[model samples]
Target chain A: MDNIEKLKLTCLHDLHVALGAKMSPFAGYDMPIEYAAGIIGEHNAVRNACGVFDVSHMGEIGITGEDAEFFVNRIFTNDVTNAPDGQCFYGMMLNDEGGVVDDLLVYKRGHNDYLFVVNASNITKDEQWILRQADGYRLCLEFMSEEMSELALQGPEAERVLEEVVGIPGADLAFYTFKEIDRDGDTVIVSRTGYTGEDGFEIYGSHPFIRQVWQALMESGRATPCGLGCRDTLRFEVGLPLYGNELADDITPLEAGLGIFVKLDKPDLVGGEPLRRHKSEGGPRRKLVGLEIQDRAIARHGCEVLSPDGEVIGKVTTGYRGISTDRSICMALIDARYAKTGTGLSVKVRKKTFPAVVVPKKFYKKSYKA
Target chain B: MIRYSKTHEYIRVEGQKGYIGISDYAQKQLGNVVYVDMPDMGDELEKGEDFGAIESVKAASDLIAPVSGEVVEVNVALTENPRLVNVDPMANWIIAVDIADMGDLDDLMNQEEYDIYCLSESH
Candidate 1:
């Protein structure tokens, strides 16, 4: 018997292949890394104009019941208690030891109704973890990952594209909020949220509806068909955290430099006690910090970070030659003593070690129209 | 005459010196070259040794030497614009090296043989 696990395909897989995109395996899916114009072209298109991404591989779960809001607040670090409908909260689901299970966005669709958007690679693990936590809650959990498809129309021109090209009015929606629209017979959810740190919208619907929207956007010629290669770069330029790199099963949200999302004032949560204690005890032993390398060599994930005296202090989580900022930068988890801004450090890139300095994590300023 | 290595590097022989660069297939595989790290002049390179690195937007790749040689000149053009390799890998040789041993050429594949080798490796 062939034991090789088959990779999953999203609704836009055929279209991506037709466009001559460089395809690679990502999170168990055969996804596009970039197209003929390459990563730089696609990246510039998003920064200056607009780009559309097939983010359908992202997992979605629906929770509806009398205790839906209460249950979500218990598992999530952000305090979403009594949040207005259509509002979205970005936070993490933590384990008992305060490590991250996953970072996700929770949408309060209505009273007693919620939706969760999670990382594509963590679909099975997130489902099992959420189900285990749902043992006592009076809520109905529905796994809609396979049935749903998503598209992110991002950049400065996203609103105009949505209104004129896709025939959807998205200017009325506030940042981090969403609205459900009835298109013909299918209900499509459109949110003014994105990971690219731009003014954009995330549209969710059935596979057919998503394919139709993708085709229409591509035909319009205003939105560039971007792939995951530029998507990672765009997010990295603005200092966003990727799950497996920045946050992991053993990396806590506080340690990942995302303490702002973990609401400490709320009632007890799944990992609340430990997180609160960790905070009260003067923060984590190791912290994530940004490093600016003096040389042009790109520091990548798993590269060792060393102190000025040559001690192995930490490891790089993510790094790149910032397309927008035009500098070699990276984020690393290192000892608290070496994480202070302006501290001297160095990174081992293959055969040589390059000098670096601790800097602010936000490499590029975000241009979100909030 | 030109020769290729299994690792996708190529050498175009001229007298006792040869111009070296990655193969066209290798450049296409490594999308969007952003930077190239090359060795200084007079540095010695052994057969199948990593002489430098080539980085793209997503990842980096090592540039392996197909034959033992001494670095005569580093392509300074690549330092300013590395994408020249992606545009034309043959014309934009990465380095010029003095051949240390003529027998090293016997181990490399010629154009026709290398073409067939690349086809077989792709599958």
Candidate 2:
């Protein structure tokens, strides 16, 4: 039996099916996993040329009011106070125990207005958590998930596609910055940001406006219509953490090797104390590291990571036959003792144990616009 | 005679030898097969047990054995280019097994029955 009752539909659902996309249930939404070009073709297109993804399934929450900055800083790990309007900061919201509640992109749209872009799967959890933290803070919460749609235009040729084909002229925006512009009488938020390790932009707008943009990009025949399949590969190659895989409710940013995003020096964040302690004392038991398998077989998620002596150290968080780098690599959360570079490790893939070595988590270098 | 299992594995028997692979419907559902993990030629495969895995870009699914047998030959071409499975799943059989129990064929569905079974499953 099909489990379509609880599953939501994205705005591009009909369009995806029209283009012969392989639809699958992801994060409670019937989303496109790939198009007719397939994952490999779509993945290579984003690395070499331009590709667009209907990331409308992602959740958006807006926080507005006087205490927006202070209140957000109290819950979020990144130092967003120093960031000016139009600046986007990537960080996590953590629980009191230093475990990640969710990792999100915080966009400061105005002095009192902030937009939080979070993973689709964590929408309800994140909203509830934020509502709980909004008790004493002077803020108004607006869940903009259903009303908004997002498109990620990524690759080396993304800027050209956006400027000429999509007709959104915010290509001049610096990386990690965004601006609201009038597009055919509709206000659209265009951010010079992406998850694919390539130079790209993320456009957030109303469903109608997003639909128009999607159609234009599709009709231009330049931007490949990518799916969540290639999106995972692209992000994994660049070592970006997917919430469920890398940053779970029990996993802290420190353990996930995202310490730079955790602004512990700032006083009184929800999970600050525990994260600070971890930073100061090296308290995290496990650390995230990259492992290169010596064999052709991929070491998939949940595979056991072991020491040469046969002791289970950790497990693989994410793995791929990296489309960009062309290597069978995986990021594993292993014991801190064996997380160093060049450390000998092995991953038990099904029956046979394959030899591996600890390498840097960044399997492919990012080509983000400076 | 070719028989299809409820698990989507198909076995084509030629005397004592049987060539095994996932059904075309199963391959289409998998989409853009990237890797096909198979047991070695000498590995024993029990009925209804997972022999290996097939990986697509989005996920990996275990390939189950429809009948008890010992792996006699594996399709080596799939190791170099796994996309062959997606191109033609029937032509790109995963392994050839020496049938341990000829009676196990009765447990599977024939072409006509399997077609009806797949039609019901889709709905």
Candidate 3:
């Protein structure tokens, strides 16, 4: 009864239902939120062992032509030039006013060929934005989201599972690298990248190929079938930002604590001048920080953040009980003066105010390979 | 006898005291129960009002009072193992209350009436 609008399904929808997954509407897709193992178990499975996710709802766009690399570096905040082939970079696309358009991954397949992976909810808007900015650039852009299906095999045992179960050769892939492999007269692109902080692999293939890999991994019983529910928790525990919650149309990477990915010294790019000015002057008016609540109440997204004197400052972007660390923590964007480490703050959870303390935004340490 | 409310809470009367908890349908919908915030003893609960919150893995829902009463006891067992609600909602009553008045029972629905209400709400 939650969703009245018609929902879209992925290639693994029937398989999720057959596995007794709890279905919910997320980013216009009827996706599985969790399976029979539940969120906590699946989350632990990824942290301790291996887990698989159907990330086909993500958007993929391909650009190829004479001026493809130039067009990409013109709009993206990162310096894509001089990077080695098969290297992937994380950066943001911003509007002229410095507000974020989307945070995406840029995969360099060759000198003039690149693959851009974006969030599912911002597909149409991102496509339109790219087209609008392609006035004088000579590049052929294609939205390949529908033709590509993605699966994230994440955990400590990911490499072993990929080799033993799926019969895929991917042990040599370093972090942030990918290669196209030939299998049975078809091509499958495997990347050593993941949303979770654990060492993992993301496999992109055709629908039938993805379905077969999912079945093979499930039958092997070495990889747990995870859902979108744990995906949020795992990413949040490592202090990664979700699009709508942390980086939105109104939030800039500088204000969201993602300035490292923004190369302000680049010759030119969208929102370059404004971001450069902000970087040179410490930061923007508001800054992001971590809050450890002294109480058990979970301060969820949009919860009002206030100073100790009860003055309204900012709001919480993401909050949860850290399943890995066993602490009640959250990320909030507050006035720069109140964002200092060890600054005392309070959050309004429902009808009561709870005391909280400012801390480093990284709640849990990342355990990535390389 | 037992009765249910439109908000999915059920109450079982024993003499002048009543036991209150959510129905099985609600627990199933809420998914895994992680924490349950309950009211303290000696707190006054008004009819058709929220007393505390029950948080599941997905979201939090308010626990509404089925009848006006004064809370006499709480389910201390749920504080340590809240998943007991998901295991057996009816057996794990959340709180015990002293009935303020007998007329409040008329406003609630019986078992058969509640079953029909759930069916209609689902469609």
Candidate 4:
């Protein structure tokens, strides 16, 4: 069968087609890349106003039982023990070798119930990993990816749209917190969390409820219908690590510059020993850094980074001519010695080389609500 | 006369010189052109050969030559504002070249043929 025949479609697929969106296959799903307004417009809308993304393709897993909290803390890098109900922690699940299996968000719904939102592409792998790690624990896991649909209403005007347009009371939510509300017999989870650096709410509910909210927001004309195209650009600008790009199976979170999230002090944490050793040994051999290209040519993924003497030392993970910043920047994994800010390097884009300097990975500062 | 390649590039023939740019449909598909990588003046481009590339916010595409020619001038304005191609792709020709052979034009499609070709591909 052809790729399209095997691809999955989200609940918003028909709506996206009706809106003249450019559809493409992403993570085994037929996803909209952009609407007629284009990536730049959609991107700017989220930066300056409001834009909503159909994030239904993301995987949702639920864990509950007497040992849910302990099971989660053992598998997750972030400390969630005794975390208050409705608190969410963002961290990674690492393999025994300390390489990242997936970066995910664990929401502490209550004393023993947790919700996990993971990348769309790593659903199967993550489910199997979670199941394998759940052995000998008194916990029940539910993969609710197909049963749920999610929308991310993001930007400066996101909270206003959530209140006025979607008619959801999300203004009280602090950053990284979530609450479940019963709306017309359906449980809708609204969280003040998003991939974009903007102040946003990620609403999760049944397909029908999500479709209703999407229609309400679209009909009200308060939020632009965004796609995965700008979603990537926005996240990249904020220095967020995409799983396959910045944090891969071979790349550790410590090397990806996410040491703060990895709680090496947490007792019996999976992969904690190696991570401690890695930290105690000064750090990983390679490190992720930001490179600001001096030329107009875009430095794309896998482009080689070279020293001034022309020795290859690194490769670009994610690069873009940033929409908000208007500067060509990229995140690259380079030799730790050359990962220092202000270090001069060059990137080979196809046939030409451009001068670049190591800078902070965050090309744009986040405007998340305090 | 304007002739089109299956790759969506168009060559506008005028005397012995030809101006080349991507079609309007191509620009809409590309969306928000960020950079256009063009060959320098006097660079030789062969028929069906890729001479340069075009980048949008999400992805990049190669600019394939429809016919052989020597680059006489590159669109310098695109260096400053590549979105000019998105605004008016035909008006903002990417390069002007001296035709290597007028016979090369015979291999391209006309307006009607290219439109139908695009329609079939879109479906």
Candidate 5:
């Protein structure tokens, strides 16, 4: 059963192979790691112009019926009921222990019909958790993962590329907002949201149509083909926390420094009480902070972060050294005392003690379309 | 003379001394080489073992030794300018070793063999 319930493939899986993309397992699909042009070329391509990503593996499930808003609001810690139509709110799906099940986006298409954009790897878990949450509630929920393909066109030139293929001006779409555009009698919800910290749009539609759109956009937009390698580095540069690295079943939003998106004042929501108490009284024993090493040594995940006196403080969650930065920068969940803007520390990588300093990150300030 | 190991490192061997670095194929595969973690000059290295690390924009990889030897020299330029490897990997040998395992070179790729290997990959 486990082997049979293997990872799913997107419509562009064939294209990835044809383009000589080094494929690897990500989320639930055999996705590309890098192309012949390599990750650096892809990373620089996105940073300079536009890059097209086959993010079709991301899950899209819808919730409907009259009590949909009420049901979603109760399950999410954020004020889901507050968003007007065509707006998306970023929030988390939390377990009873106040740890994040997954960080997701809630799109309010209508008062009753809404979409939940979730991480690809957690689709099964998210779907099951939602079903359990809705079983005793008054809402009709549906997992639309089988019915949709999601694609993201990201980079500084995302708007230009998308506008060319979609044949519609998308520059007006505000951040975290979506519009149902007519594309040959099919409505694809195009949202001005992306994970690369660049101005981009995510389009959702049927499998075949999504494939056609990918081919069309790749041709007309002249976007560089990017794979998981560039995607991970780009997202990391922007300080986005990946689920497995920064978020765990035991990792709270407070520790991840994502509490701004979690609303404590919300009524009738799961995990709000503990989160509120955490907010007021401080429950985050450890907090994620960005570290810019003074040297070239890369501090890998799980590397020991030590105090000046050689006491263990925390561990590196993710580290990346890029040509653009010319130095290694790491993110570690450390005690709040050392998480200050300029606290100096040490990272024990292998047998060497590399000098580390805390710095404000989102390493590349977002250059998103307004 | 350019020689390569299956693990992707290449060296220009001459007598008891040689300059070492990754092959063009390896550098091309790794993408925009960024950081290189070089061991101190006197550190010992074993054949087929990791001597240090090389970071590309996307990820970091360990640098494996093609021959067991004592590290008699290192390219200090790498600590400041890692692009030297990406610019001319053939020219920038990472280490100067008193190769303890001289016979190990036979098991690695000579320039002609490596050239054919790269050619096959294109097809």
Candidate 6:
């Protein structure tokens, strides 16, 4: 109800139905929101063991040309030039005012070649922006959202599961790093990265190769196919932001506590001075904070947050009762004064207010393989 | 006389007292009812006002009052087996109330009339 209908189904549509997933519309895709095994079961599965996801709906764009790193480094807020070949760096593209354009993963294929992993909804917009910027530079940028099918094998046992399928002991790929392995002795890229706040690899290959890879990985990992419903809660448990919820066009990275990724001191970069001003000016008016409700009342998105004495502060961005924690928790965008840990607060559930406490952010401590 | 509201609440009037529950349509639409909280005993409710709420895995929706009344008795069965409403919502009344306004009766629909109303929502 918080979003509109923008669903576009992928190759796993019938497979999801056959497995009894509850389908829902999300990010211009008709996706499996969850399996009938439920969000709790799916959520715990990804947290404890391993799980598979048909994330082919996410967008990917490629850049090639001389000085490609110069063009990419000029654009994203992340320090991508320092990222060696066969590795990825999480960063965001920003507007002139330093508001987030989109948060993405930048993969450096070589000195002058790069790949951008962007959110599904921003594919068209990001392509247009990248192409417009490419006009002056000697870079060739291409949107490749359709060329790859993304599958996530996430949990503690991710490496063990993938080693048998990838057959190369990809366990050597460090966190935020990737390697190309042999599929019939031909290379396919497997990156040890994830969005579910778990340890895993996101596999990318040709479309035909994905089906067999999916079956083999699922069989080897013994991971159940998790839907986006559990995916949202799983990520939220560890305080990883959703595209619309945490990273939006109007919200600046400084405001979202994402200033860590932006290197304002870098020489002659895009959006540098503006970011410097935000950094020096004591950050934004609102900051993100974690919350725990006293009651089982779920403080969902758009719910108003107030002080214990009823001073209105802000609103909830995302919320859920953790199946792993067995506690009702949420994250909110509140006045900087209330962002402190252990501040007493209240959330409006329907018509009544329930007491909650501002706890630490990243409620679930993720132990990914480093 | 038994009556129903367009929003899917059912009421059975016995003298000045009335019993309230949700219709089958409401329960079916809200799958796998996880929790229910009804109006407190002796609580006053205005016609069409929220008197209770039902939460499911998917989402949550409130139970509206069919007629103005003072809540007298509530079904404790909902606490343990809330899904009973989806199976036989009409027979499983959630609240018994003392009617606060008799004039509101004209706004309610009988079973056959309510079925026609439910039909309009069908695609």
User: Which digits, one per residue and each the tens of the lDDT, describe model 1 over residues A83-141?
Assistant: 79999989999999999999999999998899999999999999999999999889999
Q: What local lDDT does model 4 show for residue B76?
A: 98
Per-residue lDDT of model 6, residues A67-182, tens digit only? 68888888888887766798798888887777777889988888888889998888888888788767778887777788778888888877887876645476679999987766
Per-prediction DockQ, in order?
Answer: 0.74, 0.58, 0.47, 0.85, 0.68, 0.23
Best by DockQ: 4
Fnat for each predicted structure, in order: 0.67, 0.44, 0.17, 0.83, 1.00, 0.00
Any residue pairs clashing in model 4, and if so which?
Answer: none
Error in Å for residue B32 of model 4: 0.4
Residue A73 shift from truth in candidate 2, angstroms: 1.6
TM-score of model 1 relative to the true fold?
Answer: 0.97
Q: Which stretch of 10 consecutive residues in model 1 chain A shows the poorest summed lDDT?
A: A1-10
Cα lDDT tens digits, model 2, A1-370, are 3598678888888999999897889999999989988888999999999999999999999999989989998898888887789999999999999999999999998898899999999999999999999998889999999999999999999999999987777657999999898877877999999999999999999998888889999999999999999999999998999998998989999999998998888888998888788777856989999999987678899999999899999999999877777677999999999999999999998987989999999999888889
Judge candidate 4 against the unseen true structure and give its global Cα lDDT, from 0 to 1. Answer: 0.94
Give the winner by lDDT: 1 or 5.
1
Q: What DockQ score does model 3 reach against the true complex?
A: 0.47
Give the per-residue lDDT of model 4 (tens digit) for A189-232. 99999999999999999999999999999899999999999999
Highest lDDT scorer:
4
Better of 1 and 2 by DockQ: 1
Candidates in descending TM-score order: 4, 1, 2, 3, 5, 6
* Positional deviation of residue B71's Cα in model 4 after best superposition, in angstroms: 1.5
By lDDT, rank the candidates, best first: 4, 1, 2, 3, 5, 6
- Name the regions of candidate 1 deviating beyond 4 angstroms: A1-5, B120-123
Candidate 5 stretches with Cα past 4 Å from truth are A1-7, A322-324, B1-3, B101-123
Q: Give the TM-score of candidate 6.
A: 0.85
Candidate 1 vs candidate 3: the DockQ winner is 1
